[model samples]
Target chain A: MTSEHAPIIEMRNIEKHFGSVIALAGVSVDVFPGECHCLLGDNGAGKSTFIKTMSGVHKPTAGEIMFEGKPMHFADPRDAISAGIATVHQHLAMIPLMSVSRNFFMGNEPVKKVGPLKLFDHDYANNVTMEEMRKMGINLRGPDQAVGTLSGGERQTVAIARAVHFGAKVLILDEPTSALGVRQTANVLATIDKVRKQGIAVVFITHNVRHALAVGDRFTVLNRGKTLGTAQRGQITPEELQDMMAGGQEMVALEGSLGGTV
Target chain B: MTDTAQTPEQDERVKEISSFRKALIRPELGGICGTVIVFLFFAIFAGNSGMFNSQGVLNWSTVSAQFMIIAVGACLLMIAGEFDLSVGSMIGFAGMMIAIFSVSLGWPVWLAIILAFLICMSIGALNGYIVIKTGLPSFIVTLAFLFILRGFTIFIPQQLENRTIIGGIADAAEGDWLAPLFGGQVGGWFFEFLGERGLIEVFERGTRAGEPVVDGIPMLIIWALVLVAFGHFLLTRTQFGNWIFAAGGDAEAARNSGVPVNAVKIKMFIMTAFCATVFATCQVMEFGSAAADRGILKEFEAIIAVVIGGALLTGGYGSVIGAALGALIFGVVQQGLFFTGVESSLFRVFLGVILLLAVILNTYIRRLITGER
Candidate 1:
């Protein structure tokens, strides 16, 4: 797939530093259209910093980002969003007390002109929300139902469906399944597969190698703010990927010191 | 396929919601129930006390209108996840400013009113700015302003005229263009004609006879109704209303989604100040004077009315209609106790009880929404 398709987003040697701490040291990843690119790393291995830089939450201290073959700089998250790069964060960016339709159109509400006043078009918003959620394979009770009432997977689906509907050419999902149950995680993986089939580039960030392999086309491993390697789906085994995630040689040394299997 | 077919049955999301549960989810549920219960109690206890008469109705409605004005502002601000404890002080300060400008400085009544609004709203904006910039809770910031503004309300007039209370505003504003809007009556001719037709009671043994007991509706009630309508429309229909809910429900999430949470909160703060000024303007016009103690404890009253109207203390999840109903309940109960020959001080007891019930109801509703036990 990588051989035949051009990368939609190319992060070339991206590095981000916070005063004295180096969060990302020249890390690079490429996302091609219609493919799931998994970024696997243990906790504190620069996964968050790398994605934040890629999604424009932080400016890269060094290195360039090429979007559709053109060098681009995102001033903020909004800039990246307008350029069709949407990031579904770990926190999900949803108002739980609000209705599904309202959350769907939180910032970009559709309005209809009634005399001199511009009113939120509830009918349009409701129909669109229902239809979009239906297409995502989650049948909502009603558009007016609160987001908090939905299961974790359904909420994650709502967030993903929202990003895809809003013209996200490249979707960056950050630890979406971290808080989900086993069934919920499978649902999320299925949703990811559906999203990839729609020809949108997906950057799926996770620490679980099994979850990554379930839907990912390519795997990129990061350790201690540096990339260990990138491999095609068939080239990397689960145990090999898990070993790399645990800092390979470092895990071996820890096991020897403990004199027991971990 | 089996899983998909079984989802509607196994999952609670698609299950049929009970009608009782549905009714409990309404933001106005508590307020409507309280209003109905209060009205019924008053009707039975004060049946022949003329509490439902035209004059008595006017009295309670006017009082309710005052609460509605401030509660509308508080409702919107609470929905946007902030509090303005300085509302009571703002009312007193605004009235003092208007009196000082119009009565003492010989300024036109209209200009004085506008200037007071400007000053109060600027202070409101400053409150919001400090909260947003400093990342401080609005409760602390507005609490500080509450004392500061109250102190100034007393200090300013005392320094200017060697007294805290100022009079002569009615005489100064007699012919001013804007005085009529704040201190005027409407539909007087209709009431007078009704009195002439023997449809209503008239002044019988006085110097003037055949005058209706209720002449016309006061502008205060009119202002309350208009503000309620406008606030309801803004909360339910506009895009800004959605932003208000999002800002309150999850500000960080709203910000990430580009809702401009700070701007919404600041604008809501200005709105509260605007409401407080309106309240003050109407009070001064009606009383014909301004006093430092005019609006003491009014801020708490407004908050209580809003809370009883089903607005959560933590912000988000409220309605303007609910707030109006809560205000209506306050008006009826405060006036009803006097009509029923009960101790007027018992009104505070009613407020405390009702507030507790409303909070409990709101918590239950929140649990239902969040699907928590």
Candidate 2:
């Protein structure tokens, strides 16, 4: 998947600042179509800021974002969405009390007109929601089931299926599996595999090394708001990637403090 | 039966049963039960006192109708996750505006009514704007409006007429084309027939030539039913209704999905104020006068009714029908108390108890559905 086709999105020296604090300093990464480009980083390592800039949550102080080989600027998340970029935040942005179908079509609902009145087409929304979730291998009991009753992995799957059904070209998922258990993590990784197969570019951001190694086609690591390097799968081992994510010098210092015991 | 031996009909029946069970746990179910219990209590205790008679029923229905008008609006606003404490004050202010414009300023009654609605809606919009712009809870913002509007209601009348009471509104509206639409009664012939046939008790006093004076269904009751139907439709069926649910459930999530939460809340506030004005207009036309204290404490009553209807105070869940039923319960208890020789002040205690019980029941039902505890 690497270098076989032109990159779908290319970021060059993206910098973001909040007054005197630098959230992202000269960080760059590229994602290709049908590839799970894992953004590997620890907390405060600028991974979130980078993802935010890419998804149009924030404007970069200095940088250029080329989407599909053309310069792109997004005023907000809606602008990014209209341009075929969708983001599923770490919080998931779902109303737990609402029905699954309602959550699936929250901001964009289907409507039918009767006489002079326009109404939410519940049948259409329910049928499409169930069908889309089924495509991701989730057999929902019913579209009217409250989302709050769903497991964490199922919720993440719903978000992924929603992004895909909405025609998202590049899906940016921020730390999707950080709060899930082992089996749930596997489910999310499997969903990512299904998404990748659909030729939609997926930027899977996470701090978990094993989860990334399981499904990522390529990995770009950030340390203290700066990119350490980008590596293709099989080019870098999981241990090497983990040490790099923790900062190579810090890992060395911790190892020395332990006296290389056992 | 073995797992694979079940027929499609059995599967369909299982689904139907489960769905029916799901419906049973809905928030409105509590309100429905409460309505039935209150009706039964009044029927058993106050039945012989004419509380169940046609005239007595009409009396309570009219009162409930007034409360329902504001309760439906409050229910919608609550569903959208906000409050309008200024609703009671808005009613007084709107009535004052209609009185001043129609009687004092000698304007046409219909024109005055329209202007009053527009002005009240603007104030409602302002309440919404301040809450959203300042990121303040609507409770605090509308609380401020409650006092501000109440003060104006009194001060404005004193400034213009040197009195707190405005009169002659009924006279101004008497022959107006819009008077019947907002102010008169229906079903007079039917009620007259009932009275003549001795099916309904004719009033001994306040009668004209041995005929019952209260011979029709008050227009307020009709307006309430219409508003309830409309509100229910808007909350459950429309796209805007979905937005209301989304906005109330989680404003940030709704906004992230491209629902304009701010606009929706503002519109809800405007509708609430519009409903208050409608109530005020009809009352003034019926009574021929408006007082500065016309709707004092009405805000709490509307909220109480809405809560009884099964809407969570925290927002995101409710039904307009439930609120209407809550209003009916309120009317029954209020008039029933009088008929049963209970002190009217006990009505306050009844409201307090019912509100607490409804809140507790609503929370319990929600937890049951969410499987929280």
Candidate 3:
């Protein structure tokens, strides 16, 4: 779904450094509501660095982040979560042995009954987690199942589902489909589309250009800790976009001599 | 379609493994089995010669009750992954205090009991507080307390004796007020089951057709039941119960979930000491004696009961029911070996073997189900 909407999250001149190594240097990006804004880059192009800035895992050295146009600094990941921003990292932050319902309500669980004889609202937790999963276009088994038994793609889907159910306004996925096969990738991308339909702003951070092109509303390219270009859908062809991502003309020739190893 | 990543059969297999794994880690099965084996052995062997009458039953059960009560508390500590070796000394200290107040000071039984309970709870609180503040393992904290407390109880009593202190613990057991409760079979209560209440059956079959119904059931059994039920409720039902499980299961995860891990652990350490205090109170109340030499190595018995009860030494998994059963198993073994003409030294060796075997079984079953990360 495409919308003529105002931007939800806008990062201006974000700069981050780890001692001497510049992970993210003066990178700026925007995420709009009801849009899957793909943040694409190669291994060292600062894709991870940029997402960490949005996620509150890394505070920018110099720049500022604006959520709904109000500048904010996140103190921790918990603060990031409460600020309608959540990241589903590569490790899929979950206790593998814990039940799906328990993991869904890990940090924030609903309490039930009287004190000294109180009980965990397991039924409500299961129902809510299941409902969220269904809304994400994923048909899962009972929430009692251990998440460790689920497929890698399914696990990632559940993580995304969790972020959405917990009222995340800006969903930041860090390479969600990189290790999955084609069908699983399709399933994940479909799940992403489901999130976009809810009118939440989704930052689909990835390196796979085709995956980005498939579901992204806007594409931003980062290279060597600097923003190469930011383009709306259909503004630049995939080939032109690839050339920019490779660092313009000089790098194009260098890539040609390197036999397109990238 | 040509290369499917997952097979449906494999998925089912994983599900089965997880379901089975949940059962294997319950932490009660070991204790129950041990109880049954020990009970049958005693019943079969302790036939005609020994004091296996109704009064005898009450006496043994009352003795087991102290272990039961303490083991229930120790079970909680073990589930949180810690141990206290000073429980024996704690018991001595508390009992001595009770004797001092009830006999030496000529105070009433109820007042003395209340004061003693408070003193014991305070000792427990102190032990727990010290361990948490120092970040020392409970083994060291409790072990140090044990000998220090033992010396305190004995040295104080000897000094009082030297000073010719009046009424120095002579009348502590003279009255029938509180002693009858811990004594069992003479105004004692065990547990209500189905419709009938279960109490100790005491008699010599030579004169009596059935087991003699004794007066005043063991108050220790009543107290032990309260401890067991309370433990079961705390471990399985309440949010703190859930926190307890989580803390023992994985402390980091529990902390991340805002479980108040440090506070819960400190409380657990104190609770163990508190239970030791209660057990010691019952001991002196039953016997009318509170010497320093008593309660030695009682910590080992509590630990043994917990182990036999099927609690994992690693923490985060056990049941109070299992611990009670574990106590029963110990009681049966202690009495049964005498009937079978087994030497006491040999009996201990047998216990060690059973302990080793049971733990092995527990670990093997655990591996079979969880299948490792």
Query: Top TM-score: which candidate number?
Result: 1
Which sections of candidate 2 miss by over 4 Å? A2-4, A255-262, B1-20, B193-207, B210-213
Chain B alone, TM-score, model 2: 0.92
Model 2's DockQ? 0.37
Chain B TM-score by candidate, in order shown: 0.95, 0.92, 0.82
Candidate whose lDDT is highest: 1
True contacts kept of each: 0.54, 0.49, 0.11
Quote the lDDT for A149 in model 1.
83
- Least lDDT summed over 10 consecutive residues: which range in candidate 3 chain B? B186-195
Give lDDT: candidate 3, residue A147.
64
Which runs in model 1 stand beyond 4 Å of their true positions?
A: A253-262, B1-13, B18-24, B370-373
lDDT of 1 by residue, B183-289 (tens): 88899999899889987777897776778999999999999999999999999899999999999998988877778899999999999999999999999999999
Best-to-worst ranking by lDDT: 1, 2, 3
Selected candidate, larger lDDT, 2 vs 3: 2
B1-373, model 2: which lDDT tens digit per residue?
Answer: 0112112322333234366677788878778887888888888888899887777888889889998999999999998999999999999999999999998899999999999999999999999999999999999999999999999999999999999999988888978987677788898998788788877777766536557656788888999999999999998898999899888888877877778899999999999998999899889988889999999988988998999988878778788999998888888888889998889999889767877777788778877654444
Write the candidate numbers in order of decreasing TM-score: 1, 2, 3
